[model samples]
Target chain A: MNRLRFAPIPAGLPATVPFTGPETLERRRGAPFRARLGANENGFGPSPKAVEAMARASADVWKYGDPDSHDLREALAAHHVISPANIMLGEGIDGLLGLLVRLVMAPGETVVTSEGAYPTFNYHVAGFDGRLHKVPYRDDAEDLEALIAAGHETGARLIYFANPDNPMGSWLTGERIEAALSHLPDGALLILDEAYAEFAPEAAIPRIDPEDDRVIRFRTFSKAYGMAGARIGYAIGPAELIAGFDRIRNHFGINRTAQIGALAALQDQEWLERTRLKVGKTRDRIAAIAASNGLRALPSATNFVAVDCGQGGDFARRVLAQLAAQGIFARMPGVPPMDRCIRISCGPDHELDAFAEALPVALAGARED
Target chain B: MNRLRFAPIPAGLPATVPFTGPETLERRRGAPFRARLGANENGFGPSPKAVEAMARASADVWKYGDPDSHDLREALAAHHVISPANIMLGEGIDGLLGLLVRLVMAPGETVVTSEGAYPTFNYHVAGFDGRLHKVPYRDDAEDLEALIAAGHETGARLIYFANPDNPMGSWLTGERIEAALSHLPDGALLILDEAYAEFAPEAAIPRIDPEDDRVIRFRTFSKAYGMAGARIGYAIGPAELIAGFDRIRNHFGINRTAQIGALAALQDQEWLERTRLKVGKTRDRIAAIAASNGLRALPSATNFVAVDCGQGGDFARRVLAQLAAQGIFARMPGVPPMDRCIRISCGPDHELDAFAEALPVALAGARED
Candidate 1:
């Protein structure tokens, strides 16, 4: 049979994905993991209010979600002290990243992101045929200055930075992010990913003017609010750029239950704060475990910790594989130096206990290998 | 302040959508409608079992859905008698359509679809910079032969044909679609949208080999399964084409609740059959109401009936507006001849009674104005 052909843009596209979910691993191993800590999901679970709201809205799943997500947008706007028009909700920051890439970068256009930053964003850029210019991270955090320089040097149409960065949870101050924005190329747009913002210190959040068209900040329910599976995230930026999403976005893409659950999650700030405390405690506990194992824990402002394995990326891969083999799911950074550290997500005590129990054995296995 | 620059493709794209959803209409009107028949969403709702599954899964929303969507895919594969490798699920048909257009058609490549069928598909083609060649509908249903001709003439890379099509609710037998496949351009893939397949007669569904690389059939939980708001849909095709989605898709885009709900919905075939019967009854009732109003109801093989207004597009528009004013939401097609009719969705008797009661007055209002 003749094979169906792909367009030139997709013809050379790699089948390689940035990260595979633990569910895939479970399927391959033909067993469920003892604890799910890899994906940085909140095993502490969502607020009771959010769960109830979702249960109530579950039957309404037959009705398409409000295309504008007005109720949720209104709630978010009120939370942010901005107008609803300044915000656009999508299937998650991942989905919004894809749309933002589509909105800002044409085929063959240049985009700049940190070398060790989010691969999903890079995936979107490459998917759109945009040329990526990546600057390596500085001290585990996204190097804003180098990113801006790369953008300027390449005349890049897009630049991205994630605060409290993933894989290695390091963050810079909001003042640093603000100071670096002016260095961006005049025509370039900055995508400030704050997916982990809820767990970050207040000082880490930049108070950018919502009307600032030069930057679009992304936030998600997946991380701090514990609604990753809901696929609800939003972008806050200038009204015009935010509205431009409608031109290409799947208008009814967001589900009704998600809209309701996210709204309830946002409203239950008390639970959010409680989750924050839990995450912080878990972070500290993981750090203590790393110290006991003669490994160093990188400072983190997110829901995960990166433990330096005192080795290289290859060693980290061995440790990760051994951990997975023991049914404890964890991930590590993709690049060198950073890849030397294995990342473990903060979960409930039992999950962390499983990670702690499995780590030493996994480490021994890695050393033996 | 400088405005963020859009990519050349998005820049060239219009800041307009084919259909402004009823939620948007409600927002613009500053009031909610009494009955919603505009979007063709199943008002009868989803299966209780599906809803229960979603509600149960609500607390786990913090964990992102499995990127591979393995379990759901396996279930879908089993149900369809195809390998799990042959299925790919996404946010919805709209999301999948965008990816398909991106995968096959480069800028300026030709694509074919019915002149007035599924505007969202056309929107995607234009958004991706594909040149669309349209063939007019023949007798209210999509003209398969003409679409094939246009596909061959223009060397279109993609051809879209929806069985039990929208706006007009007309259909062609599955055997006819299979016969028409011979006329498709050799390498050009066909997108067989079976969104309303559950309501369609079995004869209208073809027995194409699941492994055939020549075409992809899109199935959605949105219509017959009654889960539009869940935003879950899948495409069935050959392994290679199905695998290609991993190259560019928002891997975690499918919401957790949606995955759970869709799985349960698919499992409960009894509910699906009951809903199909309910839809048939509602369709018949809608047609009867149209006949009583001295309008001609087109032969419908889907969940909605298109009632000819016995006039032109202008009259149909007027009728639609008057219905909106009376808090009854109904829509009409966009193109010329098809726009002469008003499309009403199948709903519970109470909702249909509201539409039925409002139709005559709305028609009178249109005639007067």
Candidate 2:
């Protein structure tokens, strides 16, 4: 049978996902994992208020969500002390990043990111046929300076920098990020994916003027608010750049329950604080668990910890495979250096206990292999 | 401050939505509407089982939905008698349409659709820089033969045909659509949007093979299943064409609640039959209401009735505006001819009563104007 043809850009593109979901792994393993720590999801879950809001709004699913997401944007505007025009909501930061790339970079234009910063961003860039330039991480954190230099050298249209980076669970200070602004090329836009912002120290999240046209900052209910499955995220940036999103975005793409859930999650600051405390404690516990197995847990400001396997990326792969084999779902980075660590999300005590019990056996298997 | 530049395509693209949502109008009016008969949403509401499923899944929002959407897809596959490989889930038909356009049409490639069939489809085409050829509707129904001719003439890569059409609520028999396939350009792919299929007579739906490479059909929980706010829709076609979706789609875009809700809703086919019967009754009532107002109601298979004001587009706009003034939200088409009618959605008795009460007042106001 003759196959339908793809456009030039997508013609050569592979059908792939950045990370294989634990559900996919569970399907492959023929059993569910004891510890659901692979996808960086908060196992403690969203606030009770959010769950309540979702329940209240569940019946209203017959009605379409407000296409403009007016109320949510207004609320977010008030939260950030910025005009609603500075914000654009999307499926998630991953979704917004795709739109951002589409808005700013034509096919064959350059985009820059750290070697293993966020594979989803790279996926978006590839989707648009943007030439991606990877800059290696500096001491585990996203090497902002090297990224800027690469952007300048390549005449990049956009640069993706995530605060409290994924995979390796490392972060750069807010001051350093602010300081790196001077090194960016004149025309390049900065995509600051602060998906993990709430988990980081306040000092690590710079108070950028929302009016600043050079940068777009993304935040999500998926992370700190523990609503990943809701697929709600927003980007705040210059009014003009933010407006660019409307050119290509699915205006009514966001779901009604998600709008309600995120709003309720945002309103409950007390619950956020409690989740933060819980995450911090769980991170320490995870570190202790790693230490007991002669592994070093890299410091993490986000909801996940990256434990260096004290070997190379290959060894880390074996460790990750062994963990999955033992029904403890964890993910390791794909690239070198960063791949030397296995990433584990902060979950409830029971989930963490499962990881604790499974770690020794996983280590034993890795060693035998 | 300097603004970031948009890519060439988006630079000239307008940020337009298919319709101005009722919320926007309500905001402008400084109050809520008495009845929302616009947007064609199932105001009769989703099944209780679907709501229960959503409520159950509400707390699980902390975990991102299965990127593969394995279970839901498997269920949908079973329901359709197609392999899961023949199905691809997305945020909505709108989102999937965008990805489809991006995948197949390179910049300046030709795409054909009814002039005002679905503005969202045209929006995606424009976003991808596709050259759009629009054929006029013949007697308030999309001119399928004309569309096929235009596709052949222009070497259009895609031809969009929505069964049980929106706006005018007119439809073509499946036999006619099947007969028109022979005239399709060799390489052209047909996009059969079956958004209102359940409301449509089965005879109106073509019996195309699931693996038929010539056409792809879209189905949504948003319409018959009554879960628009959930934003879950799927495309069924040849396995290769369906696989093309993953090349650019937001893999994790579908929300958790939606996946569960749609699955449960699909399982409860009894609610669907009841809703369809309710819609049929409502359509008759709306026709009677239109006749009372000295207007003619177009025969409709979908959840809405198109009431011709026995006037032109200008008169319909006046009627629509007056309806808004009277706190009834009804919509009309934007182009000539079809714009002669105002569309009203099926709703429960109280809402329809509100529309009935407001209709006379709105008509009087329009006549006075």
Task: Evaluate all candidate structures by whole-model CA lDDT and list the values in order.
Answer: 0.90, 0.90
The 10 consecutive residues of candidate 1 chain B with the worst lDDT sum are B1-10
Interface RMSD list for the candidates:
1.8, 1.7
- Top-DockQ candidate index: 2
Error of 2 at A250 (Å): 0.6
Question: What TM-score does model 1 achieve against the real structure?
Answer: 0.98
Off by over 4 Å in 1: A1-3, B1-3
DockQ of each: 0.71, 0.73
Fraction of the native A-B contacts that model 1 recovers: 0.83
The residue pairs found clashing in candidate 1 are: A226-B62
Q: Pick the candidate with the highest TM-score.
A: 2
Query: Candidate 2: where are CA atoms >4 Å away?
Result: A1-3, B1-3
What are the fnat scores of the candidates, in the order listed?
Answer: 0.83, 0.79
lDDT for each residue of candidate 2 in B225-247, tens digit (9 for 90 to 100): 88999999999998988888887
Q: Rate residue B54 of model 2 by lDDT.
A: 95
> What are the models' TM-scores?
0.98, 0.99
